[model samples]
Target chain A: MNLATKDIGQSLGRFVLTTLGVGMLLMVVMAMGGIYRGILEDATLLVNEIGTDLWIVQRDTRGPFAELSRVPPNLVHRALAVPGVKSSREFVFHTVQRERRGKPFRMAVLGLSWPSDKGDWIPLLAGRPLRQNHFEMIADASLKIGLGEKIQLGKETYTVVGVTHDMLASGGDGIGFFTTADAQAIQFDVPSEAVRLERSSRAARGTRFELAAKQPSLLEFANLPAAELPQIARPQVSAVMVSVLPGAEVQQVAKIISGWDDVSVFTRKGQRELLLEGTVEKVRRQIGLFRILLVVIAAVIMGLILYTMTLDKIHSIALLKLIGAPNSVILGMILQQALMLGALGYGIAFLAGRKLFPLFPKRVILADDDLLMLAGIVLAISVLASLMGIWKAMKVSPNEALA
Target chain B: MNTLPEANSTNSTNVSDEIACAIETKGVTKIYGSGNTEVVAMRDASMKVQRGEVVALLGPSGSGKSTFLTAVGLINPPTSGQVLIGGEMVLEGPVAHTNLRTFRRNHIGFVFQKSNLIPFLTAVENVQIAMELAGESRGAARRRALELMEYLGVADRASNLPSALSGGQQQRVAVARSLANRPSVILADEPTAALDGERGRQVMDLFAKVAHEQGAGVIVVTHDHRSLDVFDTIFEMEDGLMHRAKKP
Candidate 1:
């Protein structure tokens, strides 16, 4: 301890410079770690906040968070009838591109089943949830849209009613909620000309529209009626959310529902993991690779710093050895210096990561526990780096001091 | 720097003969390698210096003076021989009596041609560290270091680093550091070789006084003949052998 203190005091400038260099490396590591945490948090936001144990969705579809899972609305009734079902609500999801001030913003829009907070996942910070079924919207804080402001989606303009915080999808896109009917309208709304063209095409195909126009002529032809045209089913939904009775198991209910073979059922947790694996998995893998590269770079920098410091003091080490200083003292000195560098650098990096992270568009969540763990990692790497220099220092002979 | 007291013969001044034989070696041989490529750095070298005695080890280049010094210093073990310091059997045929580092710190002190002081430390701190290594309290080490510096006339330069000192002054500071732990024996390898003729002679005279007043053994390895008058005894090495020069 005494030797270490004196050595550090004597070379303050060099020590600070070396530690600063290490600090910069630490900063990058902290930022990457924070980004990883941020991704998980953002992806799990709605599911975690909603506090539901089971989710009912279409077979083989991860849905709303991962991919499209639109079950028929009637399934909600059957899910409620299942054993242990406390209650069930319908959740409608769509991806809407809204144009505000001539700029388009892609947002994940969830439609709340009214009159029940059980499935109304987000709690509004200001104002209230949808009282009216249609034309009302609750925007996420990150959506950058103010309450009372209107945004255009397809042919409809809906007024923003409330604001919610941290409610984001796995894609890190902003979230907004509205009534199921409005969401369906937004999903299926088309230009009037397109609607007219569809009707004209059906008429031109010699269907019901042609028979209506020649009704008087048909009457004149005595008792021969024009044939009726078949009706086309509107676009059907592919998934539903379900809540079960207080004592019943969702998996058991899901099994029964899935056995029907009309559709599949998924628990909320399963849906979440599936979403993460299917949609966010590629991004996570790429980020993981980049993080490993950053760690390698930090380790290399630590090794280089330790090596250079040892080289700078080669003569002193030789003289100390010649004077019969023990090998342990020399080794301890080098290792301690490396550890100190790591500690100081880790501290600097924690602050740097915290300060710079907020500016990034993606949420960067840095937890204290995570930072502490990263600090331990950095220290271990530094110790490993010091081994090279310490080994070299130990091998230095007192004979070199004779020179 | 204040001048050290001149060297004086201790026998005329009434010192006991029981204090004689501070350093002793018998048939010390150091070989560099084994088999067909072996080289003999020092062969069959033996010498002794009494307590409170100052001796000069004189030799030419490649004559094994350093090899003998290092062997006696317990750095490079001899291929064969015995060494005794302060009456303790320290070395016998590639073996040592105690841990080499502990033995060096407690019983032996070393001074080199360049002073070899740690440049980062002040002169006093540099001297104090030797005492610290010997397990002295920090306060005691500082106090003792100051006393040694005062004794060597370097007390005023205690705070100055080695770079700030003159060649002669640095040599004196090295002398103070050597005596910091009150070692039984002091070994100097060309300690004054880097200084001028006058400063070199002055350093040799100080070594002799330190021997007499401090009651410690002093051995100098040098090629300088100008300071010969200051040595009580002189041993010359030639071809890895030692021969005593007749005292004037």
Candidate 2:
């Protein structure tokens, strides 16, 4: 027994190589699992961290991220005075393609009248919050925007003044914050041809003649300047975020707010469940399948390695048994080798995962708990892999040495 | 009567029997296959070897000499027989205890036709492994291995691999491994069959010396009769039956 252990230790190189191979495979599986969990977490983190207690959106809509939910922006004023309601802020969202230098990047525009950095709405990582009403913007850091870089928003250009972390919309597009008026313009402003077509159709319908008759009388009496043309004709907002006073019952407020004929309210916890249960459900299933496949492939690789090791020592095992070496000794040798291989493979994969995972586009969390779970899974596979070799080794008759 | 050639050859104080036999087998038989294809490998074979005696088993092919040796060595189970080692009945048919592995490790030693030393282990380590497998502590096993190697005159080649040594030296190492656990009996199956004439005789002489000086019962299965004088007793097998020939 003592001599056997020394011999095994002396051949350390072979064992180490086998371990590294297995560990690398385990690392990939682990990273995939962690990244999947991270993506789901990031999606919901944006909603959960906000100080809002309830949301008001159009009926039959799955919030802003999963689907379009549009409502009149003025609905915020009505909800603010509802029973148990403390304050309300209107949030307008739209996706737009913008050019930074020569490259085109898709960014989500979020327009807020109140400062986006206030309350629990945004966590800023660098620079100051938006102070001026025009031209200044704050973008999610994932968008690769540097402070003070000019970002083209439609025909207008805005200066990036600050950056925020965890400020992203449902579609994985980073939220770019601006004044409400700018967001409405980008979302609903029609092109010249569409505007001209609308005007011609109105003229053909004879409605312009009545408006012209009434316009001169109004203009002569008030000498009024032209009303600021509503840049957006739709003028619809996706939802409103509401924050309640301390010790207030959010569910009661939500029920009161739901009484509105045109809008419905969703509590913070309800929205989180919808995101996980509805928004990313398909992606989660796909990742689950990937995880299952990875485990099976890992098992196969381990089995092949164990089988190969056993084959290499077929004759040695026979001779050992012939010399009255116990079945336990032979069995122990095979299992120890398998476990060593698994451990080595896991270590190498972990280091490789840490070094390489960040380079990937998707989030790869590699959390400590996930790693421990992965190690446990790998150990189970290692034991399973050795079963075949152990069975074969123990069955080797001492008579084989004679033959 | 069991041969006691010299005063220093036998020690009877600690052991109950005066002339302790290294190996004793009675009515040993082994059958392979069954029914339509039953093959009787050995039949009613019996032999007794006292301490400090070297015996050679001689036979033609298919004469069951190897089977008889294996049965007595405890490497193979017999169909029906009683096998005694150091005056204790250890096996009736097969070993009755679940701890047969430990029993074989401590009570039996084997040397093969090809030396069969583990390729990865050096000469000394090869011997030490046998002792280790028998559950001896590492320090004690190594110390005993070194002592055995020196006694066998292979201490100078202890560090060399089996492949690096000559056939004679490798056989000497195999002998050292066989004696590592201090078993009462040592079984050698055609140990010198692969060697040339000079090396074969040298191995036989070593076995004879180990039997005489170490007070072990040594059984050598061989076809070569040129070195017959080296053995104290000769047993020949024909048609799976053993017949005792003249004592050397």
Candidate 3:
């Protein structure tokens, strides 16, 4: 007669309910790990999918994701001049927030090197990538923008021509792809009133200069529309993405680019590390601490539960002892029950997670082998917890039954 | 071997009682605590029971009747004394001549006040476990359990749990369990306390029948006076001392 199983059978309803409560607690612990992985995947989605062999950013900065990066658009040409560099693309990234139906519509915007990189590499769920440079854009499915819908940002409206899924930035916002000119147009967009103020201010400045007063032609140049200006420098890009030739050495090409004074070059892997180590490090630690605390809490609860169960069996145990039931019988009983509880609880957590994980606001990615390690930990915990009950059981003198 | 109510099917020790003595205690004493906190629970108490005899140790609460019974039962060893079972010296003053637990399992049985059945086990399993603890094989143990259950008139309720049985039925099952190992000595402490008058009398009658028919020495410590006529001999205790009640 296996005493533990027999006892559990007698109070199956209570046993199942208790196991369910433990399973739910363990489920959160399991999901915590998946959520942390989801954050990592979200943080590096762009870096992994952009098909870049090298990233050229501003000197002394980690960007374009970990820190702000600004390099002149001509860096693409400079990178292409390297021996192993086969292709180069201009990269621009920023976030835009606009109003939609009285709610905030926030998207992490990326500018594709249009006509060369028309977002053909993007995994589209619907519609098509940017067909024209001026107004066509590709939006993530999470942005809630349907194909052919129009969204206005910065005094200009862009039509959503393509939709992608799970293409989120590190900050968990949806990403939209647009042409370099259009994205820059939105990034530097200013109100017409501010532009008017700027032109008048420039006309005043031109009149105040003694040289400008004598020439008067310089004043005519200043009064010309800001678009026709000749003294302004070209707008800078966030970074330059370089893809190496199939048979060439990437490190050799990177070594050549590293010699440049104004920019820093990084291999694709370094960029991903910067994003993971710098972007989401704290969130990972916070979730990791929570998982540890929860595991400790689970061990404590299991200990107390086993102790109380043994306490409840005092009378019967005393009687069994008096009848010459050995210490082995009592020890076997408590140990077996603890293992059953741990094994069954893990099963419930996994079965329950399968039904509920997808409903979470973030992705929860759990694989089967995760249970192998967790099950070992749970089994060890069960044995340690059952020791408390076994200790209490061994002290019960058979003489108590005579009382 | 005759089955059910004969009580002879399960034991090799079920022989005529003429030549063997079952239980004998000489000057047994049990003390608790030490120094200023020292208290004596049983003092110089002695009793003898022959094979096939039923004896009752009657006393008020705290009168050492239970102390003497536990000492002879080899559970709470006495501070000073000799305890013999089946004509063999087993205990001498808080010490044992053999492995106490194994010796007890093979030789003695116990039934408690509340019918102390393991709640999770069904009626038959409860009886079967006692023999299993004595190293009996599961098949043989189960067969004997069923025989004892039938003999105790509880075989019909073999599948029912202890909680589903009434107080009287529970005590009957407890008796069947005590008989499972075919012990030479059966000790009971207030075995019928939970039952009504008629049920209590019936249980007392069952103890006497087990003693006379099975040739096992039986000792019952109880305050129930309604069935004193059922015992073959009676001992009384007061303040750690024992006195045989003189025959009327």
lDDT against the true structure, each candidate: 0.78, 0.77, 0.87
Model 2, range B125-160, lDDT digits (tens) per residue?
889888878778889887878777887778888988
| Model 1 ranges with Cα > 4 A deviation | A96-104, A115-128, A206-238, A289-293, B1-17, B246-248
Candidate 3 lDDT over residue span B26-116, tens digit each: 9999999999999999999988998778999899999998888889999989999899999899999988998888778788988888998
- Per-residue error for A115 in candidate 1, Å, reads 4.4
Sort all candidates by DockQ, best to worst: 3, 2, 1
Q: Which is superior by lDDT, 2 or 3?
A: 3
Docking quality tier of candidate 3?
medium
Docking class of 2: acceptable
Which 10-residue window of candidate 3 chain B scores lowest in summed lDDT?
B9-18
Per-model i-RMS: 2.1, 2.6, 1.0
Tens-digit per-residue lDDT, B35-154, candidate 1: 998998888888888878888999898888888878777877788999898888999979988887678777777888888887777899888978876778989889888888887888
Q: After superposition, how far is residue B78 of candidate 3 from its true place, in Å?
A: 2.3
Model 2 lDDT tens row, A1-403: 5333444565668766667777777887987787787778767866776647887888867786566898887887888788677788777777888666788788888777655433235677877677876777888888889888887665567888888865665556777888776777677767777766765554455344676576645323222211233432447787888888788888778877777777778888888888888888888889878988999999998998898878767777887886678787888888887787787788888889889987765566788787888889889988999998888888887766666
**Candidate topping lDDT:** 3
Error of 2 at B209 (Å): 2.1
Residue by residue across A103-139, what tens digits does model 3's lDDT show?
Answer: 9888888999978899999999998877887898999
The DockQ score of candidate 1 comes to: 0.40
